[model samples]
Target chain A: MYVAVKGGEKAIDNAHKYLAEERRGATDVAELSLSQISEQLSHAVSRVMAEGSLYDKDLAALAIKQARGDLIEAIFLIRAYRTTLPRFGYSAPLDTSEMDLDRRISATFKDLPGGQVLGPTFDYTHRLLDFALAAEGLEPQKAEAAEAPLDEEVPRVLELLNAEGLIEQSAPADYDDTAPVGDLTREPLEFPADRDLRLQNLARGDEGFILALGYSTQRGYARNHAFVGEVRLGDVTVEVIPEELGFAIEIGDITITECETVNQFQGSKTAPAQFTRGYGLAFGHSERKVISMALVDRALRCHELGEDQVAPVQDDEFVLSHSDNIQATGFVEHIKLPHYVDFQSELELVRRLRRNAEDNIREAAE
Target chain B: MALDSSPGDPSRKNWMGILARASETDLENFWQLHGQEEDYDFLRRPEIGLVMVQGRAGGTGGRFNLGEMTVTRCSVRLSDGTVGHAYIAGRNQRHAELAAAFDALLQNPERQEEIEDTVITPLQKRHQQGRDDRSKKAAATKVDFYTMVRGED
Candidate 1:
């Protein structure tokens, strides 16, 4: 039993107008500019880009402004805008090795190549809030330049382990460049997904959800003795081979955070004992997200790695289905939208049952 | 546009990259000064689109879709039948058109040297300077470790 009731058009329009007024806040105060949001609230923009699966910082900032700083709402706006654009083609896979190093660190090694450059990090700072920031017009401090430049070639730490056959190779033995990768946007996700599909889903997954899952692993829920092999944040140039042009051309560069985790894996009957690997890469300086993504990535490999899948994080269907905040929010919020007919039927059934019970009690008493 | 299938010419590729990565304002200024006089027609109008960015599994593995990025592309043909194409990041149609126009002019052997001297060289220097400044700042943050000597050893 379904019915349509259309009304409140004027009320809806008024509500929207009120919302705009509320969003603007005080008239005396200056409105926040898009550049300010993009530069100052960059982490928020970065998160929106990662989850929204779009990499335009200006648009993300604009969405932030339009959504009144509700990041998920901003992400929704970006996703909607992104769906309308025509796709040119796929770009060549990004090479992290050539990233213009910003912040590169390795917890596993005390001293490695590149020597752990801590470029613009909050890691060493005190957690206490600085009252000085409240007072505007403070002069910005410039960092000192080094006498000598960093090495041209900073090698990856895992390559050292791979050289001695001490770690599992990240790529397949028979990797092909021409083979097609799985695309979730084009097709619905199926069970028993490959690493490629899983990575794609996790890359655009909700930060909070992924963080909780990663934290679960740390609390001994399908733990894999994880070690932070290396975490690098920097800019990498994006190149695409256009159909008109026969060769690749650089479009632009984007900042990304990459994490590679080495996990202890007791070799199975068919495999040799060696260190296994989990990887995470996301747009912008998302250290926590990438680190968490790596942890969950390793956990999801339980079946393939010959480990027991005993936790919710290890369940692919549960994790993948609930990871997307946009999908989760839409379904949860839809309950507020019109369930009147459904509830009315249940109400009538319950009342009828209660009446019958009361009549039966009276008859028994008589 | 005539297709030059001669492989291993790195100069054309380098210039194209420089033009793509250069700021729109800078490109516009340079175009107004030097490229405004060139007669050209649009082969394909500047169109904004998305390009799906891919990433390696472990930074060195098989490819996976990371996400899509906005790109604007255009193709133009010069009066002399030399064709130029541009694929730059972000949704700026004017920037793409200007880049395409410059690309077409650069393909002409007669105008190649002068354009390279005025437009390409200056843009390259500015880009390099920015990169150098960033690299130097990062270098300053590089950790320097020192070990204390113990008499017991």
Candidate 2:
């Protein structure tokens, strides 16, 4: 005896009503303006932009507000908007060496050139709750440090190793000038992606998933013995060469985070033993994501270096297929859809099998 | 494109930077002192809109949508028919109008020298000095390193 349910539309409407109420909990306080979300909760906006694969701050902030602070949903909102916009010309690759470093640090060398500029980091002090910050307008701010923007190009520490021919020099992985750029958004991703396409895919990959893969590697899954060579956060000027204009003009600047890992690569038949490099670049101060990306990137490079692919991270098909939040979310959410029709058929089949078994038992008894 | 290049200084980028750095007070004071007499008509009225600011991944790569920023832009023409344009950050409509007017006036040969000396030159100097001083102070904290050269058998 089975009863089929109805009113899916009504159920969906009521669910939305509940969501609205939950979103605006205690409306007497105030509705958050998009500007407040953009400026105050900037890291969230940055994350949405990075993960959404879009860079618009205002749109990201709006998405955050509309999505009730769900970072992934906000990312989805931005992505939807981004798809509608026409493609402008692409800019030249960012030169991190010439970055206007706001914060640059190294874990390898104690002292390196362009001394570690520890600018506005949460690294030092501390997880302890500041009770004063909970209340509004209590303490007056101290005057900002006399505005000395050093604007010095902090050179990478690995460059020193690179100078001595200690690190493997980067060559074009697949030698082809004017190689056609691969876009995951435009075309479905294929197996054994090139470095350019792989990086692009990973750059916009799900932060949590990428972090997990990276974590697995750190827990000795791939065990590359990687160290954070250099981590930098700064703005890089974007330039586009117009077909008519014939030269590049600085379109604007974008804030970015870049991570480089000095990885241990054992000498193989073709190559000698030296340090290998993994690069991670993201839209904003996304250290964790970028760091994770670097680790996963190195892990993915196992096959190319003639290393055994024993781990899940070493499987490009598994890693790339599952990394995208949009695809994962879509498939994951689809399960919540009404599946009565599908389940009813399965239920009927099981019932028929059970009835047949009972008849067989009765026959055996006779 | 009536001589996009400034005569004394050909770099419009430098002047644009100066204009961007100019405060409301500086813009207002300049008009009060010398720009009051300029007769200009609006070629393009001041209006605020979102401009898609783009960033390239790595410095050079495939384009990613960096984000959109609000920009207030306007254009004006002087009585002598010198056209001027202003593109500025934020939604400040009045500032855009004033900037547009000054842009037209600056193009006028009669007013170019006076505007260049009085408004442009001083602002450029101040901006340059501010940048130099900041860089110098930052340089003070720089750390120099020396590596040991090892000899192997």
Candidate 3:
């Protein structure tokens, strides 16, 4: 009666055993350590952490190792692990104005305050393959003396323009800074999302998918002219307050990447022309992700800006809903699960309809 | 954004920060030697679970699911009525229990100074040292160029 269940349990158990064995790979080869993955492959760990939405470098490292360096798989592992923990409390949003700047640059200004730091970027690197890195066991060099810590604050490029009424105002005319942000994880996302919600979606959106969508906007999909106002990467303090304590405490610092792009705007009938901004921020030094996100952010703002929403990336619901890889991957991979019961019923219905049609045709012939 | 308003009253915030930043090993080792003599009942037994991580594109933008990570959390109440809770990243139940024990100890007014000196100070030092090491490595690559002043003949 339930032949589908027969032998499946044992087969599944053995399959898991085989997978564990396969995960070990060749025993002769030295196994990759979590520390190596966390340190040497830090960028990968950062990407997984960013995409997984959890900031623990240790967990991300373990995930990468467990997933055999498959980043999406590692992200999935991190995501699943994150779901069960108790919510300590929401962290106070970071004050990036005081970011411990690692990398800061402005495309709009040649010599901006907090002079450009091209820190460890691949931008100027030749793409030549380094044969030296192919071999193993290089001695860990002692670190050089650190730079004196940057002053706690730096002038943001966007703020400089805002002071002169160049960029569109960030807050509303009567902006309440205390308004509760929409948490997409806690509640369903409503259409025509506010800037905060849209940013949240993009922040966790698949970097590759968001990059392509953002790229699309640049490639004439929504040809909005944009100049990189500022790009900064740094560590920001995370602070949280317990309800019982009734006061704030610094939790820790997390590294973040922020991009602010100034887009060209024309005067509409009701409003005067001003430079509107598109913003992107992500968990780590995801320069590409942030830049792409900024472009898409501007593209998505077309309707709000009184511009025609002709581009695919400009479709708010379409972009927001499809951007998450976890949601997308879960739904897509679910297809492999057993669907024979539903398929059988549909098959029966089609056969019955065909028989009825044949009988009707015979009667008509007679 | 209002979430940043100085978290709760400041006094407890400082200690909670200490609690949040300590590595699992540091907390465990500290508890193993110092805080292990206390009697406590499980208010919540240590268990593994998931938390949905959310991220905002660029740091302050809209939120999206980052993914999940495994966490172990435990809660306990000391015999003397002090309550404690602990949540650490990953699936180590022993670490959670030790953390919970230490958390209760930190809340104890009588033991606060003792625990802070023995546990928090060492952990903070380690965290700072780690940061210093990272900063040093990154700073090695820092390049600075100076502009020359024009000279009039």
Best model per lDDT: 1
Q: Rank the candidates by lDDT, best first.
A: 1, 3, 2
Fraction of the reference Cα-Cα interface contacts (below 8 Å) that each candidate reproduces: 0.78, 0.10, 0.29
- Clashes per candidate (backbone, < 3 Å): 0, 14, 41
Q: Give candidate 2 misplaced runs (Cα > 4 Å).
A: A1-18, A140-148, A173-177, A268-272, B1-153
**Full-model lDDT for every candidate:** 0.89, 0.71, 0.74
Chain B TM-score of all predictions, in order? 0.91, 0.80, 0.79
Residues B41-106 of candidate 2: C-alpha lDDT, one tens digit per residue = 887788765444443332233333334444556777777777766666455677777877776777
lDDT of 3: 0.74
Say which prediction, candidate 2 or candidate 3, comes out ahead on DockQ. Answer: 3
Query: Order the candidates by DockQ, highest first — what do you get?
Result: 1, 3, 2
Question: DockQ (Cα-based) per candidate?
Answer: 0.77, 0.17, 0.25
lDDT of 2 at A177: 37
Model 3: per-residue Cα lDDT over A1-366, one tens digit each: 111434578889999988877887999988988998887887898788878877778888899988888898899998787675666556556677777677788899877666666666788889999777787677655545556534334688888888888777765466555666677777899999877778778878899999999889888898888899888887776654445345555545677888999898667799677888888877767898889889998899888788898888999999999998989998898777777777788899999999999999999999
Q: By TM-score, who's the top model here?
A: 1
- On the 0 to 100 scale, the lDDT of residue A178 in model 3 is 63
